[model samples]
Target: MTGRQVIVRRARAEDIPGLVASSAGLFAEDGGTRDSSVNVDWPREHGARSFAAALDDPARLVLAVEHDGQVVGHLMGSLTGPTAKRPVTSATLVSIHVRPGHRRARAGDRLVEEFLDWARRQGAEHAEVTAYSANTDAVRFYERSGFAAMTVTLRQPL
Candidate 1:
């Protein structure tokens, strides 16, 4: 459906199933293809508990985007306070996903916009997210959303 209206709002307990589904989709499309070690089944097996606790945490933001009264996307974020070595508060955009059919419709953008707004309000001095270096689409999306490279992590197989 082109030009359809989509709603972005804080996730409620009832949205957990949708959140889990979208997260599973992310794992399958992102980590599943990018890395062989990722457990694609984790969302289906453990997401309900994790997401439920997140819904109750004030330092966490779980957002769901719905179109035609069905969840089409989800975003998960967390706040981090200052530490001895790191004195600045921060927010991490933990995970995000929009159904393939719902992509290019600004659903992901809407989710990120809400997440950044929430992070700012929570006294976060910085916001960050990590996308696999090989995931060009995700990296481009994050760059377009105003994120730039802060660090590069090189890895070697054991």
Candidate 2:
């Protein structure tokens, strides 16, 4: 709530539309091709339904960052049991977005901090998030927020 007076809070099912719209712009700003087939709106169309079905499920947590009563950012996370690679309760940040006008104003950092707090409250030992290597700005932001480069995902099309 620095430059824009944002308020971070748990996301409700009704906030899906605004969240999806913000995500679309964020993705495009990061150089993602404007392909509706490979965008947030597509997943939202289906994911929102699933999210609604799991609204009361303890494993899922969705948060929205609102500025001046308008949603300008979102963070979606899920809690998972211990695994061989990550041997402790953990929360993974599935997606986070802040509108372009709101970028570089510490809005993203605030949203992430809030998400981490939520994760810790849910008994997570560690919190994780992923960003495309091509999105260097986001990578830097996460790094500044105390995250390190853990793994890299490479792809080759057949």
lDDT of 1 by residue, 10-126 (tens): 999988999899999999999999999999999999999989999999999999988888888899999987998899889999999999888867888888889999999999998
Cα lDDT tens digits, model 2, 55-139, are 5678877778787778888777889988898779988887888887777667778778887888899889988888878777888
Write down the lDDT of every candidate, Cα atoms only: 0.91, 0.75
Give the Cα-based TM-score of candidate 1 against the true structure: 0.96
User: Which pairs of residues collide in candidate 2?
Assistant: none
Query: Could you say which candidate leads in TM-score?
Result: 1
Stretches of candidate 1 above 4 Å error?
A: 2-4
TM-score of every candidate relative to the true structure: 0.96, 0.82
147 Cα displacement, candidate 1 (Å): 0.3
Model 2 residue runs over 4 Å out of place are: 1-4, 34-41, 50-54, 83-86
Model 1, CA-based lDDT: 0.91
